[model samples]
Target: MFWASVGFVGCILISLGSNIVRKTVERILTAQVIIMWFILLICVFTLTSMNDWIKFFKSLVENFGKIPPDISWWTLASAVCFIGAGGISNIWYTFWIRDAGFGMGSLIGKIPGWRGKKTSIKLSGYLPKPTKENMRRVKSWISNLHKAFWLVFFLMNFLAISLFAVLSNVVLHRRNLVPSGFEIAVVQAEIFQSVAGRFGYFIFLFMIAMLLWGTQLSICEGIVRQLADTTYLVSRKVRKFVKRDIRKWYFYLFILFAVWGMVWIVLQEFFSELIKPDFFLFLSANIGLISQLISLVMLLYFQYFIARKYLPKRLWDIYKPHPIRTVILLLTACFWGYFVGMAWMEKLGLLS
Candidate 1:
C-alpha cells in the first residue's frame, strides 16, 4: 500500500509535468488552501494549550545556542540548505521569471504545453538593447522581483517553518517522540486530536498529504524543465532532433525519472535487508549537499563570469552586483562546502 501510494503520487506528478505551467500553478494555488487550514490549526492548538507554548519557550531558553549531542553535522547542513529553497530549487525561479516575462526574461519564450498551438520556442533568446529607458524599466522590474521574493516567499516560508517548529517542540519533543516514517503523520494526528478533537486529526492528515503532493509536483516540474532546458541549450544534436519543441523532451524526461523511481522502489523491496534505512537517509543528505554545492558554484559563476562579462557596461550602473551580498554568498558557500566535505567523508567511513 505504501509503495502503491508513492507510485500514485509519481503518476500524478508526471501527468502535471507534461501539462502547461498554468495547470501546475493552478494545482499549487489549490494546494495553498492547506496553508490556511494549517494557520487555523496552529492558532487553535496554541490557544488551547498555552501551557505547552510556555514549556516550549522555557525549553528553548534552556537549550539556547547549543546543539544536542544526538544531532549530526548532516542534520545541521540539511537544515541550513533547506530553510529556504535549497540546491537547484532556486534555479527554477529563473524559469518562472522568464515564463512570467520579467525584465530581459521577456525576450525568452516560455515552455509551451503539449496541446498548445504555440508549441515551439527558440533555444536562445535575443538580448534587450542597452537603451536608457529599457535599463530603467529593467531595474524597476528587478527591484519588484526582489521585493516579491523577500517579502512573499522568504517571509511566508519563515513563518510556516516557525509555526511547524513550535508545534513539533511543544507536542513531539515534549513527549520525547521522534517523528519518522509513514507513521509520523499518525502520531502527529494523534497529538492534534488531543488538542482540537477528531476533526483536527483528519485536518492534520489532509494538510500533510497536500503538502507532500505539492512538493512532489514541484520537484517533477522543476527537474523536468531544468533537464530539458539544459539538454536543448548544451547539445546542438539534441536541438536539431527536437527542432524547437522542448516540451516533448520535458515530458519524456519526466517519464524516464518516474520509471527510474519505480525501479529503485522495486530494488529496495528486493534488497530490503541490504538497503538499510540509514543508507537512504545518508543518500538523501549527500544528494542535498552536493546539489547545494552545485548551485553555489553556478551562482558564483553567474555573478563573476556570465553577468560581469556578458552584461553591457552601460547597464552595469543599474544592474551591478551588490558587494555585501556577494561577500556573504562567498562566506556561506565556504561554510556549506566544509560541512558538505565532512558529510561525504563520514558517509565514506573516513571520519574517525
Candidate 2:
C-alpha cells in the first residue's frame, strides 16, 4: 500500500510537470523508448524460435471465441474492452492527437501549467480553407495519420500482445499454471527468467513497472483534459469561472482527481474487507458495456450526421469517412448491447 501510494504520487507529479509545455508530454513519452525497446527485446528473446510462435498462433485460431466454462461471459467481454483501448477510454486518443497538433487541433491550444507563460488558446478550431495548397496539406496529414496509426498503434500493440501470448503458451500453459491478481505479472516473469537467469526476472519486473507508470500517467492526463473540456462546454458556471484562464479549471479538476484517487486508495488499504473483489469486476464490466454502447452511437452519429451537416462541402470530398469503420462500430455496439442484456437477465435469474 505504501509503495502503491508513492508510485501514484510520482506519476501524478509527472503529469503535472508535463503541463509545463505543450511538447513535454511527447518528451516524457519519448524517454520511455529505452524501456519499450527493452520490453520488446525481452519478449522477442523469450519466444526464441518461429515454431513456438507458429504453434501459439495455431492454438489461438483453434480456440478463437471459445470462452472457458469457468469464466463468466461478462468477464470475457470486460477483458476484451480492457484490452487495446476498447472502452470510452478510446476517446482519450482524440485529446492526445489534438495535443500532438494534428489537423485543426494545432489551432486549439493545450492545457497550460500553473507556472508557465500561458499560450493563447481557443475553445474551438477552424477548418482549413479548401484551396489547392490546403487540400494538398490535408492529404499529407491524412497519409501521415494512416501510417502512424498502422505502424505506431496497430502493429506495435499487435506484436506485443502476440509475443506475450506466445510466452504464456511456452512457459505457463504446459505447467498448468494460471496466475491471478498480483501474481499475474510475477508468474509471467518466469518466462523471461527461464531464458535469461535472475537478470531476466528483474528486467521483466522493471518493464512491467514502466508500462504501468506510463499507462497511469497517460490516463491521468487524458481524463483531466476530457473532464475539463466537457465541463467547459456544458456548464456556464465553469466557463464563467475559468473565463479565459482554462488552465485554472484544468488544474483544479486534476487536483480533485488526485484527491479522490488518494482517498480511494486509503479506503482500499484500511477498509479492504468492505471492498469485495467481485465489486471491481462488476464495475469494470458495467463501464465496458456502458461506454462501448454509448460511444459507438455517438461515433456513428458524428460520422454520418454531424460531420456532413456541419463541415464544408469542399472539405467533404477530402475528409470522407471510412465505411468499413462505420460498419465495425455498429457491429461492436450490437455485440455489447446483447452482452449487457444477457448479463442483466442472468443477474435477475431469468437466464438460468
Index of the highest-TM-score prediction: 2
Residue pairs clashing in model 2 are none
RMSD of 2: 2.4
Cα deviation in Å at residue 248, candidate 2? 1.7
Candidate 1 lDDT, 1-352, residue by residue in tens: 3644484466545454545664555456555645755655664465437776576678778988676667666666566666666766877877877777787666667776565444555666766678878777878997998898896568877666756777767667778999776778789789888877988788777777766666656666678778888887788887678766776676677778777666666777788898665566556656876787778778788767887788778775567768897887788788779878876676578887
State each model's C-alpha RMSD to the native: 3.1, 2.4
Error of 2 at 147 (Å): 2.4
- How much does candidate 1 score in TM-score? 0.86
Off by over 4 Å in 2: 19-22, 190-195, 276-278, 347-349
- Give the range where candidate 1 is weakest over 10 consecutive residues by summed lDDT: 10-19
**Among these predicted structures, which one has the highest lDDT?**
2
Clashes of 1: 0
lDDT of 2 by residue, 263-338 (tens): 7778888888997545675767667678779988987888679888888887877787678877877888887887
Output the worst ten-in-a-row residue range by lDDT, candidate 2.
14-23
